[model samples]
Target: MREGEKEERTQPFSSPEFAPVKLGGGISPQLIAGRKAGKAEKVHLVIRRLLRQRAIQEGKAFLDLGTDSFYPFFQQYSATQQALQALGDYAYTARWYPSSFGLLQLREEAQRFLRTRFNVHIDMEKELMITAGASQAFDALSRTFQGECFLLPDLAISTIHTIAIANGARPLRIPLHPVSGLVNLQEAARLLEREGRPTIRFLYLNYPHNPTGVCATRAFFEEVVAFAKQFQVLVVHDMDSWYQAHISGISLPNILEIDGAKEVAITLLSFSKEFGLPGLRIALVAGNAEVINALRIHNSEYSVMLPEPCQYAALAALQAFREDEE
Candidate 1:
């Protein structure tokens, strides 16, 4: 080690879900090891590979957070279980190919669910799309984006960072204000033009946001839409608000509902939270018809459509649970 060279220190600590932590600012073990190994990029991927391997091999249960899928009496409490069960014979002869976007009924229910719950209306045919899961949707979006640089929050699910890096998009990490816990849109946008690039990529936002529960208001979303149009940037809004318990005086608004949002933004939605169906991998990305068309082509060729049974399971989920238990 060189005497004057500074070593990056990684501090890893466990915290409750919805609680903010300062891990991204601190170096991660993988990053530090990657630098020390002298094969930085390769080493980073290797460590991530090993971590995922360990998670699968050990069968560690994530009970405190993101554990909505865990229920002791799985079928016993599930209203959708019967619906899933009824398809025992039908599964044998179900259609092999699901519509590229999604099934009509599922999209219909999803649209109604959003409209009734949050006042966000998603058009089933042209606007909404069903994907395997939120992660896969983000993975595709990171690559589908036409620009070279995107923004990442200082703190978020680690996978979000990996998706951007894996797709060759530079992530401009924006720090959350200590008091507000909000990403400064102005500061983040400023960094986009810092490099004087001709085209700036999308700003990916997750609200009722992951790791941090901070949410944006309708008015703020309007500002974001204006900001995107002003700078000619695309906004990727991940409203993965599946696990939200209703908070008094707070409302969840889809970015699409804001006028001009469809011009510049695409929102991601998931049925994972309510249905306890994460493994089933049923989620939707809706809004921005052009991006949807682009994604439709990319997804049809590269993405594996979920098995036909999963679609039925998704329908059962949307039809079954009226309460947000998660």
Candidate 2:
């Protein structure tokens, strides 16, 4: 080497190399770990095997009611159909994309809906958003508010199951009461106490509850709000089936009605269930102005905003809902 010339550095080896050994039929055991699938993946294989065995014995005529999802075959209300028809020409030309929060007209209608229906006042521009659906809304939120851990109900939609996982977040499970099928609020409160509340950044509670069909009382929501404020945890309340409560002659209270709920809670109200328009996929979200703004930003970058015509269709669903009441 010449003086003042720098030597080319070589990466140092930590251990001696082993001689290459041939495996059976040139197959690498490390490359194919046929035995290394996780329990969740293995469960699907187990179900397939059980299904095949059952088919052999039962001749493929059996019914399985294991999953929560059910076929929705209800008739479409006329107002909804007519509204989509009204959008026939505009849908093609209504192409100017909307705010990441959602369309202005839909948000305005939703603002009125909240005033008349829930008596909650929100600034449509800052505090409310029109989103694709519950899953998409939650996906954006789970990404927006990600922290040390997210607390999810053990019995929740599959979307909940995967949202935290997709974000590489550690999710802690909150179980519901086995007998009443209501959220085990006491257990949750205890966990919050134990986990230093702020460490668990969120508590996702859905009512007019999915899967279990159990609803929570306004008193419970008040308790949740107080607890959330105390612990510095954000409360996510899903009111996707709020309309069903009214249809069933049951009064479902909104958490936002409770005092100070705005500080700690956000509510998701979905039109897909009420309007029977899952394919169109629309929902409303309202909460703290800061959080809503964060959601709006994340949605603009990472998610699809609700289209203009679908926003109009959501307006029609509201019209039909009122007509049905009359």
* Candidate with maximal lDDT: 2
Q: Which segments of model 1 are wrong by more than 4 Å?
A: 1-62, 71-90, 93-95, 243-250, 322-326
The global C-alpha lDDT for each of the candidates, from Candidate 1 onward, is 0.66, 0.69
CA displacement after TM-score superposition, residue 319 of candidate 2 (Å): 2.7
**Distance from true location, Cα of 156 in model 1, Å:** 1.8
> lDDT tens string, model 1, 201-254?
677787877766787778778888998888887788887654334335455777
Q: Per-residue error at 212 for model 2, in Å? A: 0.9
Report, for all candidates in order, the number of backbone clashes: 1, 0
Q: Could you tell me the lDDT of residue 196 within candidate 1?
A: 74
Model 1, residue 99: what's the lDDT? Answer: 65
Q: What is the lDDT of residue 69 in candidate 1?
A: 46
